[model samples]
Target: MELATKRNHAGEKADLRALVNGQYKGDEHALIERIAADLLAGVSARAGEKPGAGKIVGLSSKAACREIASRLAEWLIRETDRAVDARPSCLPAARWSPEEVLERTGMSKSTLYRGDHAQFYSVVPPGKKNGRAYPAWQFIADVPSHLPHLLEILRSNSRMQVNTFFLSEQESLDDLSPAEVLAGMPFEDRQIVASAQQRMLALPVRARVNKVNALARMEVADLG
Candidate 1:
């Protein structure tokens, strides 16, 4: 609803509670009916009409309504993730090319690319093709020891999203970014890993799955 209102798809104001009219009666089918009706109404409004002006007369069947409602939920998750990704803080501080990574870490190309020594944070830079860039912070000090565990929790996130997770200051970590904390000595891996889990949980399930699928597709492209 916030996304719809902000995008001007839902004009003036939008409230989910406002849609409740005592007709639900705790029935699951009725709940779907309400969601499908509002979803259809919103779609029509996007085409050029008042949000509630769309009629449900041609919905066809309950199955169709359920499908529409499911699609609507997925769209909301996607839009929300887009909004999150648009922040400048989502970008890594520095990205190193393969040669730069090899020079800085003094590791063999075979070891570096194999991801055996370090689970290097890999990402494709904007407008680039045929390669991946590694975020610089992942190789900082003892941080590499804790990186694989943290990355496991954030595997579903896009590389930028993972950057955002690590670079942004967290209230849970005494207002230090995970990178800052991990770069220092005596940090508990559990604390940082738990912080990552909390952040990941904030995203919708399908959004996480979408990010995971997107990352997998990018990996396949890189392999090709």
Candidate 2:
């Protein structure tokens, strides 16, 4: 009996022997192998039917095609969602190097990273390079005058939490994120401060205490 054959656009026949022996590689190969198997099954079923018997070959092929289409559609959807979610949305849109930060703020490295109590919020991004990256949102027009005040308000939170705070929308600030509220051309510093204070206050007492305690523990560990 003739085995099923599938040809690529280049008119090259796929290795049905290798595919049947489960020696194929990668998802594309596996999909092609499954399709080949389906076609072979349809052919075998037709060969078994009597010469005058009503054929169900079309129905079998249609069912296999529908299944392959559904699976392919689902795979595509999952891949698209994974690609979207893989994007770095949690971090600020702009991460400036120390050189860029110095260019923007004209602050000396010592002052920029003055031990634990640095002038600016910074993070060490993952990788062997292991250098600091400053979120550009903090330096909207050469570091807003109220930056220190905002940092002080959120001292209990870690740098990551602080970043999250700025990006998060606060209803108290008319549903705008702290970054957005503060970045406004004619924003009231007091209003932004109040919104931040309200957000901190709104946290559960236990959560606030836990975060503060966690920060304290980290500091103590650093000292040791």
Candidate 3:
């Protein structure tokens, strides 16, 4: 029996040994979702093969390809349970260090230390005594500038709070994060941004006491 393969421009087999040597930054569900999407795309691209993905050229028949995809999905679901048993731990921080920010923004350490860059970026410290790490997403492409509204909103200079607010889903922004809405096209977000244009505010974590109290009426939520 042989395995499926995809080749690169150099005619070498592209590595797909993710099971053996992959450092996954995300969880298994997302990986499976991506695979599912890829499968759909490949199948749809083919003109007419009884309404399915193209036969794996390396395989004997179209049924084999379908079987492989089916088995892969089952495997993903089954493997997730085992992964839960293993209890892997990880800390994901999509933040850039001070030096990285300096290189990306063409600014100096002294400038950042002097707190002059606050208007231009969101800076969060990893912990006490550690210098701030900036969220790279805050910066637009090669612009020596920051959004005027973010400057005012993040004025409290509490990086943790500001990052949470921008990253969270906002009801006013149609369930999209403020950061995403800000980064998107103008027409779509014009009303929301315009409505928010006059305000200078800060992000803070709010405790939903009512929701917490409602836990007695339903199954306990996964706090973690």
TM-score of each: 0.38, 0.38, 0.36
Please give the CA lDDT of all the candidate structures: 0.51, 0.49, 0.43
Error of 3 at 39 (Å): 58
Give one digit per residue, the lDDT tens place, for model 1 in 104-196: 655678867777323657777669775778876665433444455456655666676666666666564445555655544212333444555
- On lDDT, who's better, 2 or 3? 2
Task: Assess candidate 3 and give its lDDT.
Answer: 0.43
Local error of candidate 2 at 188, Å?
A: 20
Flag regions of model 2 displaced more than 4 Å.
Answer: 1-92, 115-118, 126-130, 185-224
Q: In model 3, what lDDT does residue 125 have?
A: 61
Error of model 3, residue 153, in angstroms: 3.8
Q: Write the per-residue lDDT of candidate 3 for residues 2-79, one digit (tens) a residue.
A: 233342211110111122122222454545544544555456566354434445555434455455556765764564
Q: Indicate the worst ten consecutive residues by lDDT in candidate 3.
A: 9-18
The predictions' CA RMSDs to the true structure, in order, are 17.6, 22.8, 17.9
